[model samples]
Target: MGNENSLREQKILSYTGFAAKANKIVYGKRGLRNYIRSFQRKKVILIPKDTGSRVKLDVIKHCQIFDVPYIELNYTKSDLAKTLGKQNISVVGITDENIIEGILKTIQ
Candidate 1:
């Protein structure tokens, strides 16, 4: 079970890396808020476990209001940031349809 979980995490990390490279991901709290508000495309917001409760609540509320889906990752903010080659990323919104589909499929 542990090994399976690790593999899933690895796959998610790989997809996140690809999204970052393709410019399909919106980073930071402000960016995610703006993207979810203005964009009508299929997207999945990745909120790491280490994110502050207040920020997480606000993000979730926005997602609910906009009918967007979000995932609270088991990984921490630093882990996610390192995967995307960034620093101090609190939230991430993936805008690519293919990546969104791929991640949702993996989760289920």
Candidate 2:
């Protein structure tokens, strides 16, 4: 069971990396908010576990306003940053519907 969970986590991270490589994701708090405001194509917002309450609340509010789904990842900010091949990324907005579905399924 532990191995299965680990594999599932790896798959989620893999998809996140793919989304970044495909340019279907937006990173950073400001960038995510801006993407949510301007892009109707946003499918899901990924918030890492280490995100601050203030930023998380703001991101949740935006998700509510835009009718976009969001998931709080089990990973930390550094884990997410490493997966996305970036740095200090707390919030990520996924614009591709297919990738969103894949991630949602994996996490669920």
Candidate 3:
């Protein structure tokens, strides 16, 4: 069970990496909010487990208001940052439908 969970996490990280490479990833709450407001594309948001309650609630609220689907990942902000080759990020928004589907599927 532990191995399965780890594998799933790796797959999610892999998809996130692809999203970053394709420039479809938006980092941080501000960036994610901007992306949600500006784009018409189908999007998904990933909030790390370790995110602060205030930030997490704010992000989730924005997502709900905008009708964007969000997932709270088991991984931490640092885990996602490492995958994306970025500094620590509280939230990540993916605007590409294919990548979003891939991540959602993996999580499910």
Candidate 4:
């Protein structure tokens, strides 16, 4: 069971990396908010478990307004930063439907 959980986490990280490479992901609070407001594409927002309450609340509010789906991942900010090759990435928004689907599957 532990191995299965680790494999699932790896798969989620892999999808995050692929999305970053494909330029289908937006990081940071402002960037994600802008992407949500400006982009009409289907998106899913990933909020790390360790995100601050204010930022997480704001993100959830924006997502609600935009009717975008969001999920809280078991990973932390550092985990996401490492996976996406970015620094201090607390919020990640994925704009690609296929990649969103892949991530959703892994998380579920």
What is the lDDT of every predicted structure here?
0.87, 0.83, 0.85, 0.85
Q: Count residue pairs with overlapping backbones in model 3.
A: 0
Off by over 4 Å in 2: 1-8, 39-42
Q: What are the per-residue Cα lDDT tens digits for candidate 1 across 1-108?
A: 888877777788889999999988897767887889875577888888899999999999999999988888889999999998999998998888898889888778
TM-score of 4: 0.82
Prediction 3 TM-score vs. true:
0.86
- Per-residue lDDT of candidate 4, residues 1-108 (tens digit): 988877887787788899999988887767888877866667788888999999999999998998888877778999999888889889988877899888778767
Instruction: Report the C-alpha lDDT of model 3 over 1-108, residue by residue, as the tens digit.
Output: 988988887888899899989988888656878977766667888888999999999888988898888888889999999888899787998878898888878878
Misplaced by over 4 Å in model 4 are: 1-8
Better of 3 and 4 by TM-score: 3
Best prediction by lDDT = 1
How does residue 7 of candidate 3 score in lDDT?
Answer: 88
Q: Sort by lDDT, best first: what order?
A: 1, 3, 4, 2
Instruction: Arrange candidates by TM-score, descending.
Output: 1, 3, 4, 2
Worst 10 residues of 1 by lDDT: 33-42
For every model shown, what is its TM-score relative to the native structure?
0.89, 0.81, 0.86, 0.82
Compose the digit string of candidate 2's lDDT tens values, residues 13-89. Answer: 78889999998888776778778887566377888889999999999999899888887877898998998888888
2 or 4: which has the higher lDDT? 4
Residue 108 error for model 2, in Å? 4.3
